[model samples]
Target: MINLHWVILLPIILGTIVKLISIKTAKKIMVLFQSALLISATMIFIEVRKNGTVLENIGGWPDTIGITLRADLLASVMVLLTCFLFLAMIIFVHNKNYADHLFFFLFLSLESLIIGIFLSNDLFNIFVLIEAATLIITVLIMYKKANVAIYDGMMYLLINVVAMSFFLMGLGMLYKKIGVLDFYALETALSQVKDPQSLILPYAFMITAVSLKAALMPLFSWLPKAHGTPSAPSVVSAILSGLYVKTGIYVFLRLQIAFSPLIDTSELFVILGLITAIVGFILALAQKDIKLLLAYSTVSQIGVIMIGINLDNPMAYWGGLYHLMNHAIFKSTLFLTAGMIISEYQTRNLAEINGVFKHMPAVGVATILSILGIIGAPLFNGSISKYLIASGSSGTWIESGLILVNLGTIIVFIKYGQLLFGSSGKKETADSDILEKAVVLTLSMLCFLGGIFGSELIAILFNVKLTVDRLSYSIKILLFIGSIFLGILIYRGLFKKTNRLAFITSFELGFNEICLSITLFFAFMVAYLKLTL
Candidate 1:
């Protein structure tokens, strides 16, 4: 029988070859093969769940020497989610005029690369897969012929490539000292070396690199430009926000396991995360463009994950990981809904676009449910993860940080939710869009039900002991209510008083990135001095 690992690679290889046939057929392959792969991903995901991690070595080589496919519970969950989002995107793209076959093909290539990244135990493999993903996405963002798309994509590529280079250099340094590039191998080397400083340079390199990808700060400049301006098919919206950005969390988890020597950086992560959360929300609140608002919101949500990583408790990791899932689910829903809104009407400014729900009631309901989910309102998916991420932090100084995150998200969504009911939800006449309605209804269901079943979902994906205390529930309720109240106050009080500014061009954007890079370099030097001679 063919190995399931081999089974997974079959389509990727076929896709590479398909382009020689016809661009039209190549584009269609994303729709065709991803459907089969989705089914296969489900079956394997279930199998991996029951039997423990699956290790598939290519060319029948042993695990340590050969390229290996390692599917742990983490990979199973992430890759399955990737496939689901990809399929949903295919449906969203079905009727649109794709610029070329490359767009369609890249979708699967990206899907496969993401699967490969999650499933690979080898660090080098992850790098290759990640680079592949970055290349594909960069090209996708600039799929059009215009300069805005081209310039934005170029900036994204340059920054990401620099980050990726730093990460590689760090890996090379680690490999030089340890002669191994796999996570398990690195763990063994880390333990045997005894010189904790053996990893100062490499550890420093990777943290900075991954932080860039994860959009932790300073490294996050590309996120707004890349994601906010993409063609943003509904499913792609879901995947980029929900699945792609979470790779940083995966890197952090792996770092914890492999670079235990550098565990001290957890505190640093916490401080930087707090900074990121506050700055990101403030920037988000300042935006006039709706996509940019959501883009800044992405920065804030990632800050939430960093808090969990920095908190570094098993429970904190649990919450961080849990929020990882929730953010991906709801943020994707919001972005996709944003795409449909743009398609139905023609504007992306929250102030300009209104009464969309009137024309497309399903989109309206989806928008409302996604808003509720994002705000962590009662019984929606966003609340569960929000509680974990918040509970993952202390209820004191840092807790206020999480509250700010909620309030910022609520600020933007309320702007949209209120708009859908007013003068903007429709044009001259309110007409029903059955196709648009169906898509929105599907996502809206996920948004609502994800919250309702969050606890069970958490248990199924992660083995951490998670308990929902009454106090936890009460705090979340209070935070949600307080955020809504504050949003209203801010809208009435400050929004009317504030002027519009683009976070993208501001000095603050560069300031955050420079601060992050300086911090990472400083941490690296200190680690080197302390660990080495």
Candidate 2:
């Protein structure tokens, strides 16, 4: 039995060696390594499922003194997802020119860093891994070196660095107060403390940083630029939207658990999430670039996931977790398809490109399936997750907020669906490679199959059985249908006529402004925590 620790280390070690080899050799090695990694991750996940949470202390030292690697169901599931996604990504980009040795090296290193973040039981180790991943992603986003990609990369780097500095300060405070960096030890130590309120400053610092990382409202200015940068490879954009952002959400979830004894900020997060969702889609509705539209949609989905998890409802929590995975599949598919569309049309503007369905039927089908998934159409994955979240919050404002957000999502996608029809005067571009189509098709099928077996999937993934609420499900289906019509009318009446609000859509916060926003957010969180205490 291979130790779980080595799973995280092997990728980094192999990636380094592959970097020195020829590009062709590196590609072959990466494919094999990623395949093996997926199998190994699956084995680890199975072992954890059978044996319960697995733990290892590095160097044979005790948990309190040594670095601790742990894999609970959450960590194992995320690791498995990461492995599968990275392998799919490798396949997706195989025929593309971006498969040079340096790209693969950074890509594999990123996989290792993400795995490390999920598995690390030490808070400090998580911090370090996140920082390393941030640096790597910065380089990847700007690899093409065109059209403000450098500025986007630099902004991404600087903002995250500032956020991590806050995290480090919080880590320092945590160590000073609890005398341990290990999560288990910190929990025990925090429970014994007489004044839990004293931990508020550290909690505020860490969560503020996490909020930025998660791209919450007011701090999400960097997300569109980074994810939609003209120069970033489609696979990079997909990976960023699909997996990397989830790391922030994952850390946010962990932080909430770790700090639960100190504070219950669930209500605050719920409100913040609702705001993020509303703002995100509104911005998305105003975008002309296809990639930016998808990017902003990601911000909205992240917010919805946030709200679902923080609702303090178990069913909603499970739904939120499931949605995280679903968003990854559908959103990545959208980005990849959009990349192909942009490449073929020689333009990113949705208004100019037309007749994708006629020109590229397979890509069109994938795009439609993904659109169904995103809009919570009755038999898609989004419906299952959204239904679960709604059922968990019957008659609450949160439910209403969710509906509004869903409506906004529909409006944006309805506009996006415009790219699928009409006539393109130009001839069709080269057909997408077989592997590219396969990747999108597979994800689209998962979205369908997931909804078909939604209940069973939830039970299998989270070990929790849930009965379907038939009436609620019917109502949700009805609402979704209504929203589709409403979205079309709204788009035809308003969005089609005006480019008003173009400024808000194009406006980006400068570094100084972003820093100020972070500072203000930290202050607000601190104040809120004090008042509640």
Candidate 3:
């Protein structure tokens, strides 16, 4: 089979190569370009049909000098996601002006960088692509004329750029000890490091860098504002909230898998994941802007995936990867649906979106199904991984915390339900775009069917023992109960009274950012201390 590593990078490279000045034709040309990508991705997905990993070494150098490109189960799943979601986004903006060449450039640039991030075997190359992704996405967020959008994008840039700095520094420090810049090299070397200072410092830096990108706990403040501010294309939002965030998580997963023995940090990840899950949902309850609420909810879900990785059980490990793919599917659906509502109603204020289901049946169904997914409705994608999260651990205390997270997820989504179904005292009116309807319906069906048959999909994607009947049963019932009763309870009790605007000025939010910065600074200091003292 022909290696399509270059195919992944083609759109961006070609887009930059052919920078046509006519914005009128830019959208048309961009769609054609993306169509090509979709084709390439589809073929690649088919090419890697077996439930295993594939590696292509570009330039045919020795394995040490070669740039290795791998299409494992994980990479194939992402390719399908990016292709579908990105196409849906293109359809969403079909009628609009694609006059800005820069937006198109950034959009495709992001796509290329994403493929690179996943496929790159070298740590330094991954770090470079990560930064490139951050740069383009920051610009893409501010594609509109909104000041809030600029503020959001700027802060996102500021925070993640610092993260990239940390990432590169970690690479440099690791190279100083291990004399290698590739992930395969580092992973091979990681198990051999004996010095506490040499090992701990680089690993710590890598973790912080990835944690910031993944927006776990303290590093999550920028996501809501940045993702919420711009009227991003449905596809851009999908990539941002879905796959881009996973880059960081992927980094974490690779590091942990390769360096698990060198690190005794599972419980540390658990503690942080707990905070991320709880705090994100709490803040999600406080949001009146649909985008912001969903953004915070994404943060919460990240914590959930993080929890899965932290548990270290085989079921939990695969479950985390499962949740990561599931989140990409369903959460992107939620964001795309929200984007439709915003596009139709011309607002992000969920307070005004009451009864949105009444007029737009397609959108209503989409919203409800998305909410169900978030709530972890049975057979749907979210529940499977979430169930594993709660049950993956052995301790009563961990189980109890997982329950709280589950309950919290249920409650916050209830807030979403209310926001759509007249919680804020508005009626759903008729204004359905065919494009929006098609996109939402397709994604909703994907999630719904994905849920009922995800076991098969999981088996095909990864050789894990995830069967439909095996995962189906009592757990869904308990979660559903929470989704109904406790959800309403949290909605009316704590969520109903929460303020949305306060997030910008809230002490909790402010303190979170300040604390994150301090933690990062202290991390740097510790590196210096580890070396000198």
Candidate with the greatest lDDT versus the true structure? 2
The ten-residue window of minimal lDDT in model 3 covers 419-428
lDDT, residue 407, candidate 2: 93
Q: Give one digit per residue, the lDDT tens place, for model 3 in 1-533.
A: 53657767776876675465566566676678777678777677667775346778888877658788878666766766676667667666666664256766677777778878777778888888888788888788878757877777777787777777777777788889888766667777877877556566677777777887888767777777666675556566777887788888887877777666566667777878889999888888777778878888899889888888888687676777888888887888888888777776777776677667775678889878877777778767777767666667746577677778878888777767765664434354566777768877887787777677767767766656754334445855665775578667656775577654355436534534645773774476466446543
Give the Å error, residue 69, model 2.
0.7
- TM-score of every model? 0.90, 0.98, 0.90
Cα lDDT for residue 507, candidate 2? 70
Error of 3 at 487 (Å): 2.2
lDDT measured at residue 20 in model 1 versus the true structure, 0 to 100 = 75
> Could you tell me the lDDT of residue 526 within candidate 3?
62
- Over 50-163, each residue of candidate 2 has an lDDT whose tens digit, in order, gives 888999989999878988999999999999989989998998888888778788878889999999999999889999999999999999999998759998999999999999
Q: Rank the candidates by lDDT, best first.
A: 2, 3, 1
lDDT of every model, 2 decimals: 0.73, 0.89, 0.73
Between prediction 2 and prediction 3, the one with superior TM-score is: 2
